[model samples]
Target: MEFQATLGQIVTAVIGAGLQLRYLEEYPEPFWRPGDLSAAAWRGRLPNAFALVASRPG
Candidate 1:
């Protein structure tokens, strides 16, 4: 959300670059501790970050 690009835009750009998307997943918890108590507790909410797996064309 912070970035100007949307998730769909990013995926499209990656695909356009000749990389195939293998997997995409959202994290359940913050990778790092946040100052907010809710985020620090990782209360099973929607993730703020995500994991994307892409591979170059074979």
Candidate 2:
């Protein structure tokens, strides 16, 4: 079975793996789309995806 993790859990896992947390950005829209959609259409909706940036310690 597959296990889903919360955002905090994922971030913590990354930190535990020796990566320094840099930044994270939550996206309002999904990367894959079923049809054409406008930015205005996503304004009040919840985020469907996010982008995270981390770097390994030098």
Candidate 3:
């Protein structure tokens, strides 16, 4: 599959929607590496997955 927007774009959109960024983690490879079942083997790959937590103001 192809990505329409980038990480920065997604973050910007979230901020624009009035949500505050709390945590952000980027995985250097697909979170579920189909080929490499071991973490050590996939540790040095390029990032393709993102994990983030955002919240709205009280």
Candidate 4:
């Protein structure tokens, strides 16, 4: 899938994550953020998996 978001969001998220982890952060927003992306900000940062299972309304 393609990646979305302007350069600002990318920069902000990266910097925030970096400061939070005290390292150079480099990871996409976890869980969900439009496009299907995989990122690793700080070391030991757990990433979600493929084929998400969601429940439907009755």
TM-score of 2: 0.67
Runs of candidate 1 exceeding 4 Å displacement: 31-44
> Which residue window of length 10 is worst by lDDT in model 4?
48-57
Better of 2 and 4 by lDDT: 2
**Decreasing lDDT order of the candidates:** 3, 2, 1, 4
Q: What is the Cα-based lDDT of residue 35 in candidate 4?
A: 54
lDDT tens digits, residue span 1-58, model 4: 9986654565567555543323333343345545554345322265322222223223
Cα displacement (Å) at residue 53, model 4: 34
> Model 4: number of clashes?
0
Which pairs of residues clash in candidate 3, taking residues 3 or more apart in a chain or in different chains?
Answer: none
Ordering by TM-score: 3, 2, 1, 4
Residue-level lDDT for 12 in candidate 1: 95
Provide the lDDT at 16 for model 1: 94
- Tens-digit lDDT track for model 2 on 9-40? 98999999999989998877776665666565
Predicted structure 3, TM vs. truth: 0.68
| Candidate 2: regions farther than 4 A off | 33-44
lDDT, model 4, position 36: 50
lDDT of model 4, residue 13: 70
| lDDT tens digits, residue span 1-58, model 3 | 9878989999999999999999999876665667646665377566768899999999
Question: Which of the two candidates, 1 or 2, achieves a greater lDDT against the reference?
Answer: 2
lDDT of 1 by residue, 17-56 (tens): 9999999987776677656666533786766567899999
Best candidate per lDDT, number? Answer: 3
Highest-TM-score candidate:
3
